[model samples]
Target: MQTEHSFTLVVAYVDDLLVTSSDSTVITILKTALNSAFTITDLGALKYFLGIEVSRSDFVQQLSQFLSEPRAPHWSAAVHVLRYLKGTINFGLFYPANSGLSLEAFSDADWGTCIDSTRSLTGYCVFMGNSLISWKTQK
Candidate 1:
């Protein structure tokens, strides 16, 4: 194919993954690589990531999503997440042992961002040294 594209591996849960980026061609290339190396499926495009809203950004070269918005992904969205996993089953999250052990947190919220329930949402992420330790978004 001929197009602009990029790809990123978001997360891996067991045999599943969440892959994303702005390039359709890169996605296609990733899918081809995955199919060659393992059992695979291509759930084109990312509409959801980690239960948050996900869609292409206006720049046409990136993806964006909120941190606290609740969502129920449709079939394709779920499949996209799954395909992401298939493409990156070997990836791992590593916090280097020699890295600092200090703990730090960052948090912010948007009041009444949810139009459906008129409730504010909370979003937070914690880090240990230079590694992300935890994160959450709730309403």
Candidate 2:
């Protein structure tokens, strides 16, 4: 359905329906129309859907999380990650409006650094126009 500010699209699969729109008003209208024809319940704003947590703010839309059962080591690792995130809560990548569209990357590896596995640890970051778009580290 079309609205002045946005267009709404509904994708139906089995008994589930995902309604999407850029404008909240359009979404509201679509929900009302659907309710009139079918017994559908609004689940409110999207948060944790399936296995992912959806978070949005004025400058960012973040999808986070994976399904995992924590073991003892995993629990301690999770706490460490939480502490790191808390310490860098305000840190983020920023791109200026006039930034050039350029791609850059940096990577490094320490051969045989992991004593237990005798495997190297490697990490890298990819940037697009001065904005870091992807990063990863692993053994």
Candidate 3:
């Protein structure tokens, strides 16, 4: 409800309660009311949002360059990427079901940073609102 006096909105997302109000007192009052009804913990101020974790693409891309005559070091680097991915599996990209029609695109290039070919290792991701639609990395 929107009113000149005050308006508060509470959104529940996967065990998280997001509360926002036009008035600060309304926020406190709402929190107190919710806390009394159900046990809740207030985590203050958003800090670091864990985004994608990736080693430099050129380094990872290099490992696959010489496919016919791949050396031991190349194999080691490939294994490293696998290990890193496994370690950060819990923090992988999340695409929620509900999304809007906001198209967001991001692209990055290492600018001829490939160890062997010296070609640009480029990558891009497209998102519709908060949902990731397509992504790619190439040399």
* TM-score of each candidate structure, all chains considered together: 0.34, 0.37, 0.39
- Give each model's clash number: 4, 0, 0
Off by over 4 Å in 3: 46-108, 112-139
**What does candidate 1 score on TM?**
0.34
| Ranking, lDDT, top scorer first | 3, 2, 1
| CA lDDT of every candidate | 0.68, 0.74, 0.75
Error of 1 at 28 (Å): 50
Residues 1-139 of candidate 3: C-alpha lDDT, one tens digit per residue:
4579988887676777767676888889888998999999987543322233333336644665766798888778778889999999898556676866678899998999798999989999988689786799999
Q: What is the lDDT of residue 55 in candidate 1?
A: 56
Candidate 2 lDDT, 27-84, residue by residue in tens: 8877899899999988887675432356666411211222245466656666777888
**Which candidate ranks first by TM-score, i.e. highest?**
3
lDDT of 1 by residue, 11-88 (tens): 676776676545655666777788899998656666754433465545212123422453555444656766998999
Ranking by TM-score: 3, 2, 1
lDDT of 1: 0.68
Clashing pairs for model 2 are: none
Q: Of the candidates numbered 2 and 3, which has the greater lDDT value? A: 3
Who wins the lDDT comparison? Answer: 3
RMSD of each: 15.1, 12.9, 19.2
* C-alpha lDDT of residue 128 in model 1: 76
